[model samples]
Target: MAAGGEPVRLIMSGAVVGQELAAEFGPLPPAMLPVGVQKLYELQLEALGGTRQHLVLPEGYGLTDYDRERLARAGVEVAPIPEGLRLGEAVVYALNSIGAGEGPVHILHGDTLIAEPPLHADDVIVGARRSNEYAWAEIETDASGRITVLVDTRAGEEGREHQPVAAGYFSFSSGVELLRSLTRMRGDFIAGVNHYAAGRPMRALGGGRWLDFGHLQTFFQSRLAVTTARAFNTVRIDGLTARKSSRDEAKIWAEAHWLQEAPPAVQVYCARLLGFGAEAGRSFYETEYEYLPVLSELFVHGALARQPWLRILASCEAFLRTCAQLSGGGSGDAALKALAADKTAARLEAFARETGFDIDAALSLEGRPAPSLRAIAERLVPAYDLQSGAADSVCHGDFCFSNILYDSRVRRIRAIDPRGLVGERPTLYGDVRYDLAKLAHSIVGRYDQIIAGRCRAERRGADFSIAFEPIACQPWLEAALGEMNVRGVRGRSVPVQAVTVSLFLSMIPLHADKPERQMAFIANALRLFLELDSQ
Candidate 1:
């Protein structure tokens, strides 16, 4: 009933359905199936009548042993092919061994699933769907449907309307001739079809349902579809329904999993904040950080209030957790302490090596009496230490105006965009002063220009009070730190005053324009540091 004469039908083995089909149609003469999956092939033999003649390729000689044994048992001839010969070559060899001898041999991929019985031997049947439905091929059938030209322009510019439809089925007139034709071609055998089709007439078969189950997603979907179809008497309706249901479930599951596994807010904030590096693709980590300000603004503006508090908390916790993880050695408290120590000198030393700075000279300047930057930094360090050491808990790394989200109407403070999580170290975790200093930086930094511009436009007058007063920020910082049990420094107007001064001074070199401001900042920082060191 199948092609190639001698009542022989060749089914490529190795894929999911190959073995099953082979066994079901057996007893005529078992042809050795491809060796892809042995169990499935054995199952196919059992399914078939078990009497089919199978032409087996040699073991490791291009065809697998499983197919060869099965075919040999079925009284089919076993042909040994060259080890490296391709699938098309092996198919041609098998056909030649079966007395089909060359000419046009139909080669089919092992994986294609067919729903109907194969066409007659003389007729070349190609699986085709509506052009709009599949869109893979440019098909145009002739009027009589007798002479069909399936053009495969996968390689050339021969822009034919139709492509050689990819159903795992083909029929060749002569096995040896087909094998020789394919052997001489530089391209793969399927590609050789284009040249073979040049003089031969090919026909297309429409009205059959087929599917490709190559990728994991597609494979699962196809398996589910097949299972559902087998269970239901009417496969058409049930298969479609199963596909839709599975796809929907997959999407929901994916979303839920993503939400559950979402990272911390701080990590997100940092990623967005940093954006992408010039050398790499968009840095997801940096993007999250960079976008924190926007997220905070949204929250403060009540855009995110509609979200559940649990969600907000989860995001915040994720950020803190991430920072703790990156702190190195797993000691969150130690990381905070080190950060608060203002070990910028050591960090700068390392940076100097990378940037070709005079590391020796910079270290020499440390503790050495000097004017300009060194003198001011030394003076400011002690003042900073006094204020910083008085805090009840660690504040957000840069809890400034930009990082704070506040509701003016409710007067509620919502801090977002945490840069790092500090551990409960007495020295580093004590104080609202560091936070206050950061707040000062935020106000006095570039935002001042924006506020000025806005004030000029409103004519309501830009007052520092609208943003934050230095005095008002102090209480807020103190209250925040107090809530965490930070003890205020005794007899000090503001806790961590020296630390704040040092912090402000550090910003001078990075921020100030005028020489006077720069000099003033350096002098204050040097004084604070020196005083703190002495203490």
Candidate 2:
């Protein structure tokens, strides 16, 4: 930017994101997933000095009110990228529309993850590679690192001359001069840079934690990278107030302790990832959410149309069906099994507190005879298709009332904080029944009441018991039961028992900071285990 001149930045997010990545998370539009813990779009802004530049995104790519508000919070403007324009033209169009006025315009790919962006006043498009694989734009650079021969092809062979890569990211004095050469550009970032490189050569810089969001494999790889970080960003104790919904008619809240816990790249993907994992893989569980105008809000005000049971059920159905249709079907059984066999009980004990029962004692019951968890798993394994994720199974890894948003007046509901996968792995269709079990836990286990402090628990040595208020969300309970058919779910209601038990274990993280809740959760797990074993 010139002295005393305003700065503008354009991010070309209109280019549809990878289909595989979208399918995993279900109907997620481009630039929605995270690179580390932050959303791709946010990553761009963060990389480009967030809130400093007047930001703009491409139009015609329909955005949700939630998305708009999120961007608007940081001074971003949206503009239309003319139809049938190339990537080059889109940048130019955004520049003209943004009207930053005679200053440098920085352009970035909406989905690219730039970790250590070394921003400078130079014409360059940069990316890195793993042993020269999947180069977006094959670049041959001179000893001085100035790009010499550039072609957007991965064909033929490779050598030191054709180094680094151009990963849909660049800096232009202004895209104005590159427009005429971009008449037919479509989705190609290097094409526009190549056009401008006719006279002024654009260099290729590599290295740093740069990840190309070019495909599904890379996307998941990025997700795992965040997960595997030794110094990963974990949950922090923040007193931040909750945000209101896009409609402004409700509030969205979560445990401040559990919110914003993911690595910087994927942190905004959801409220929080499962800092605690169980017998299921290290898949993301209930991230956290609190919907205001909560059911209690409407109930207290007398504006409730009726109990939101049906709407909640309908919302669950809609969410599951979408996951099923979007899923293709695949299982990381070996990975899943290894992932599920968590040996981190000792670590969790730190977060747990003494209650009616010992969490350690409850945990020791795993693979034991009295609890006979093996038998419960035997019955649930086939029913839930946990191992294979067969063609018909798709799950909402965490399906419960806490993750739901409901409007009593309109009788509408929306589910939030999904696992986004059956077990957070690849699948055309994951275990559909998986969601059924989770939803059932809320209804049968009286999970919502427990969270709301309406349950009682007692423990005597090896035996544990819980007394929950008779469910009041009868409509929702019955409808969800009918949908998942968990009433006769397994002989002797074994599936419900087993699923509820799993939920008991899964919920440890929600109450990680509370000893009483942790013991209650563990006791419930034991109670459910005993119930399943006997019946």
Candidate 3:
């Protein structure tokens, strides 16, 4: 609430200079960029507290209806101001356009977030941090922490050794007073902010745990800090190496083996295995660290045009083809069947036993009748068979978008986090269909988006419905899948969609940590099955 007993309004400025990020991380604005499992806007909303908030965007920004609906659900109103305006001008334009009443209004920069925000209704406050890396305004505070001056560092302000710089958060006592001060300054954001501070007793609040995504270097640094780690593994990253340790010794050992034994065709597309050891009864291995964007982020949140996405898929297809050609083993029909029918059945049973949600019953998906999980798995076995004399290929068993990293500079991708084990045995070879199924699950199934919270599922016993946020990449993904089907594995038809559905069903017990995720997996599995059953 404001000092006047009205709800405090927040105007979040997302119209920062973001050409560098756009060129590297696809075409989305900085606020919409995916960082780890959440977008920057979602993280900002969680950090900045306010009941009513307006996200100020630049003109000509193409926000999809699904994106708008998601933002509205989070209680954020989108406000677009004139393009190419100065930060101060944009903020003023948004405030005026939104008709912010004469009450306390808080301003937060979209590219930054403060972990422990120190905002109060009594006085105006500017959040400041001790950093000199990026172009941030320097703040001068009096003995009582009252801000006396704000120097715009981007305007050639000489350094006096990295003092407290404004970290892009502000609190105002009166909206009308701020408007007058900003109007007098005439589009000079820093000057207008200084003018407002001069009139009011503006104080400096030292920001604690500030995360900046304003610049390229700091963007990757902050993003790496928040990357979610899998429950079974612990990864420690340094300047040159990423060390992965796991209590499950077999998992770690198999991963190391796969990395080391990978042929040149596959090894060229993977991180080099550095070393391995044991400590404190846990197994550990290190890999060369490369700062690259995850493939899932680009596909889910990136606004890149169609051709670029198709190009990436083409590169992936080439890699998969090479995997089949160079690393073929004996025909593993029995292994494939066991993975599809036996493993899925056991996992589904375990899922029901643990969660008390029986998935063996028939479900309705998108108003279409879908059969039970067991029946789906049973029918999916015929699709799991590799054609006669076709050898099993050495595969990155968990070849999903999340496990793949893309280097935009070279237009190349690297695969990480291989499944490593095939039926409790440490081996680099598996049914090529399994790898195809994994990729299918990412694109056609939209599993990565679901993990990133871009999906909704409503479940009541045996009935379930699911919907994912519509993305621009959908048609491109469909084209890629169509192309993949035309170029079948080893000149034999592959049941990628059927095997993909089975993958989702079998992985339910492993993701018990996130019940929502488990349900989402089931819901998605049903959706895919409905499509297959109709066909």
Candidate 4:
């Protein structure tokens, strides 16, 4: 109702099949009309903040038989009309006819849910509206103070003027004259207003957030957008920080108390224990503590040293022969078979038990089944043959980046991680290409870091003869063959390394994890295998 004492009546129209609209009028003449009018009248009196002087005409009513019965019980005045008339149009006609001479009539859509009482008659209220070049549907305004419109340009060719403006909402003056004038417009009432106002200046009221439950995609997108926004806000409110102060402190302490040099007697003792001859033992001991002097001469001075390949093969053969001799093995061929069949598991178990270490657990984590000690010995036999077939020379048992120290000034390579022992036969040997290949592969894989940068042959002074190189890995087949030679074990090339690389590539989806490198490695291995099989 207007504050100046003019009577105000709310005219609700449109298909009212649902009880949503009629249910709002309590204890007053039912908007649908019949018995419940008393209760509806009371509701209207309470809602409008006035008495029963105003007449309520809710026209354009469309309700199911059941709903009609309920409306009749509520004492609503039902308007009689042809069954097929468009409900929206009929409602407009009814409101204009009934409220023509009234002080002012406010027409509201029945489908719009109003959470609060109607505004004062003089104050205009707006809902949501979307605008296109040809037509606009008014919608609720947003807080940004912008009139948003859902513009559809698809019909511009059909003589529909399209413009981008928020649609689905509008407001007009509640003056009796203005109401009569609006009611006189003939065409689709909503479209008439939009068309009439196309070029005129109208006060624009902004819209708020709104949801149209008309489509599934819109529903889902609304939910997702809201959820994402909330999550982002939460993360912003509660940030994260790193925690490694204790570790950093420990590292600092260790560095500060580090020893500059080791005792002279320690070298002699290590050499003797390692079974190296006096001079070789001394060299090994000195090299272990600092390999710069030796590496510098080899890499920088280009010292005439034995080829790395020959050394690798020779060392492998030597290790196998020494094991066979210790076990009272008769011949190479016989030893190989025996070693393969030997109960190495029990030996490895015994060693672990004696040392109080969990070798099985550690190896399992590396994706390698713990092989028996005898199986290990047998694997070494093929390596012995490869060594003997290649050449006899001093082999760096652990030929890897960490084991070979570098002197930047001299640019030499020196073998630091050495296993000194004599072999009874000429061992397989070649250039250092394979070692370099393994190193390259290792660095890329970051496997060394995972293994804690420990020497493959010595962990807590325990002798384990597996070595890894960071960078400079050989071709798959050659590396496999070299490994077989070093282990003194022979078997048909199984494509194990290639398969492993493929598995790794597949397991990691991130491109930065080296998918291409792994793929290339697999391809090369497959090519080599196919060629070998053909031969």
Best by lDDT: 3
- The Cα local distance difference test for each model comes to 0.37, 0.48, 0.76, 0.30
Model 2 lDDT per residue over 116-217, tens place: 664665466665664335545667777887777566656345544535666656665544545444544543556656666766666766536776655655
TM-score of each: 0.32, 0.47, 0.91, 0.25
- Cα displacement (angstroms), candidate 3, residue 217, comes to 1.6
For model 4, the run of ten residues with the poorest summed lDDT: 235-244
Residues 1-535, model 4: lDDT tens digits? 4433543344343333233212211111123221111112233333344321223233343343543444455444444433334533554455555543534444433222222333443333344433222333433223553333322333243323222233222333433444434455542555444433443223344334432211222222222222211111111111121111122223222211111111232122111121111231121111122312121112211212234433433443343333222222223333222222222234444545544544333221123233322333333334323223322222222343334433333333333333221122222221122232233323323333222222122222222223332222233324444355433323123222222222222222222244333233223222222333344
lDDT (C-alpha) at residue 280 in model 2: 26
lDDT of 4: 0.30
Total backbone clashes of model 4? 114
lDDT of 3 by residue, 1-535 (tens): 3565443455455464377777666656568877886778888877766666888887788787767887898888888887778777777788889888778777877777777666555345546554444567788888887889987666344455747777777777778777888889997877887898888888777656777887767787778667668888899887478889989999999999999999987888888899998999899999988777788888788776777777777767776877777545555554566556677888888888898775667777766777787778777777665444556677788888898887666777788888787778788877767777788888888988888878888887677788888887786686666667312552113466777889899998998888888888888998887777667
Q: In model 4, which regions exceed 4 Å deviation?
A: 1-13, 16-88, 100-102, 114-118, 121-171, 175-184, 194-202, 206-535
lDDT of 1 by residue, 317-370 (tens): 333333333322233233323444454344433434444533233221233443
Looking at candidate 2, the ten consecutive residues that score lowest on lDDT are 244-253
Candidate 2 displacement at residue 267 in angstroms: 31
lDDT of 4 at 91: 42
Q: Which numbered prediction scores highest in TM-score against the true structure?
A: 3
Which residues of candidate 3, in runs, are more than 4 Å off?
Answer: 1-11, 14-17, 62-70, 121-133, 142-145, 154-158, 238-240, 332-335, 356-360, 485-494
